[model samples]
Target: MIVVLIGYMASGKSTIGIILAKKLGYNFIDLDEYIEEKEKLKVKDIFTLKGEIYFRKKEAQYLNEILNEENRIVLSLGGGTPCYGNNLDHILNQTGVISIYLKAQIHTLVNRLKNEKSKRPLLAELENGDAVTEYIGKHLFERSHFYNQANITISTDNKAQNEIVEELVLALF
Candidate 1:
């Protein structure tokens, strides 16, 4: 089964994915890392050198390739994966694939993203706290439609990793 985790940046998809995979004995694959290794560049570098269109195409290809595998695994998708293409539909059609949205409040998201903003190209460009808040709000408004299409949505606002993991385990399987 492919348990795909999706949400806005810093919503804890990767973090919760690792815990869920470990608890369920499933392999965990962060799609961004996979793309980095394949393209031989950091994700930010890919966005810089090749452009977002190129990166999105590669990401779709990687997602298609991984969907063919038979192993039970959890995949953490990039924030924009579902919003931009046919990726979400492709995922929905595959058997044994359950989509989980790690939904977080805007304030919580801003706080979580503050420290790690440098690593994320999109968030790195925001000028100030208000910018960050507005950025998240606008993007979340745009992506929430696709995100809400997930089979299960877990609120990660102020929640501990283990607690979220427990909720996922009970709700998913």
Candidate 2:
């Protein structure tokens, strides 16, 4: 089985996926990192060089590749992964693929992402915490439709990493 972790930026998908994979003895694959390794460039570089349209196409292709080929793995998707192309439909149609959305509040996401904006291409232009909060609020509103389609949804606010993982394990089993 493949467990796919889906969420907005700074929603703890990668962090939770690593721990969940460890607990379940499954390989952990962060789709962004996988893309960087395959493309020989950072995700930000991909956006700067080839552009988001190109990146999204490659991301969809690579996501299909991974879904078709991997097993017993935990996959962490990019923030916009499901919101693009036919990614969400493809994921839902796949057998043995379990999708989990790590839902986080706007304030929580703003607090978590404010310092890390430089690393995020989408959030890079935002100037301050207020800006980040506003961006996330709007972005999350748009993306929540895709995210809410996941087989499971776990709220992550005010929870420890281990607690989230534990909740994930229970949800899975």
Candidate 3:
């Protein structure tokens, strides 16, 4: 089966996904990393040089490739994967795909992002102060509909990795 992990930035999708894939004995594919490897460009560079639309197009193309892989995989999709083009629909159409969303509170996201903000292209250039909170709130509100379409949602706010993994296993199995 193909387990697709979707969620907002810093929502633990990648973190928990690796663990889940390991436990399930499935290959782990991080979508963004795959793009970086294939295109020989970092995600931040892709967005900076080619712009979001171009990056999204590449994302869709790579997602199509991911679907064709023969091995079972737990794929960690980029935060905006669902909102971009027909990627979400393509994923849902696959009988083996199990979509999971990692949901986190705005405060929790801000806290987690504060220290690692420099690593993310979008969040790194924020206007400071309440900018992070405002951004997370607005972005999450806009993406909630798409995120909610997942087959399962696991809350990561104030929870340890093990706790989240346990919940996900229970939900998925």
Candidate 4:
């Protein structure tokens, strides 16, 4: 089985996925890192050099590739992965693929992302925490439809990493 972790930026998908995979003895694959390795370009560089349309297409292609080929793995998707193309449909239609949404509130996302804005292409231009908060509020609203379709939703607000992974294990079993 493949466990796919889906969420907005800073929602702890990668972090939780690593721990969950370790606990379950599954391989952990961060889709962004996988893309970087496979495409030989950073995700931000891909967006900058080839444009979002190209990146999204490649992302969808690679996502399908991973879902079809991998087993006993935890996959962490990019923030906008499900929101683009037929990605969410692809994820839902796959047999043996369990999708989990790591749902975090706007304040939680803002607090987690504020200090790391420079590392995020989308949030890089935002001036302050207030700006980050407002941006995340709007962005999350836009992305929630796709994210909410996950097979499981785990609220990460005020939860520790281990607690979230424990919840995930219970949910999966």
Q: Which candidate is the best by lDDT?
A: 2
Residue pairs with colliding backbones in model 1 are none
| Pairs clashing within candidate 3 | none
Root-mean-square deviation of every model:
0.8, 0.5, 1.0, 0.8
Model 2 per-residue lDDT tens digits across residues 1-173: 99999999889999999999999999999999999999999999999999999999999999999999999999999999999999999999999999999999999998898889899999998888888888899999999999999999999999999999999999999
TM-score-wise, the better of 3 and 4 is: 4
Model number with the top TM-score: 2
Model 1: worst 10 consecutive residues (lDDT sum): 63-72
The true-versus-predicted C-alpha distance at residue 2 of model 2, in Å, is 0.3
lDDT digits (tens) for residues 1-173 of candidate 3: 89899999999988998999888899999999999999899999998999999999999999989987645889999999998788889888888888999999999889888887778988988978499999999999999999999998889998889889889889988
| lDDT of candidate 2 at residue 115, scale 0 to 100 | 85
RMSD of 2: 0.5
Q: In candidate 2, what residue range of length 10 has the lowest lDDT sum?
A: 126-135
Q: Using alpha carbons, what is the TM-score of model 4?
A: 0.98
- On residues 1-173, what C-alpha lDDT tens digit does candidate 1 reach at each position? 88999999999989999999999999999999999999999999999999999999999999888888646899999999888779999888888899999999999999988888789999888888899999999999999999999999999998899999999999887
The per-prediction tally of clashing pairs is 0, 0, 0, 0
TM-score of each: 0.98, 0.99, 0.96, 0.98
Which of candidates 2 and 4 is the stronger one according to lDDT? 2
> Model 4 over residues 70-92: C-alpha lDDT tens digits?
99999999999999999999999
Tell me the lDDT of model 1 at 76.
96
Of candidates 3 and 1, the better by lDDT: 1
Regions of model 4 farther than 4 Å from truth: none
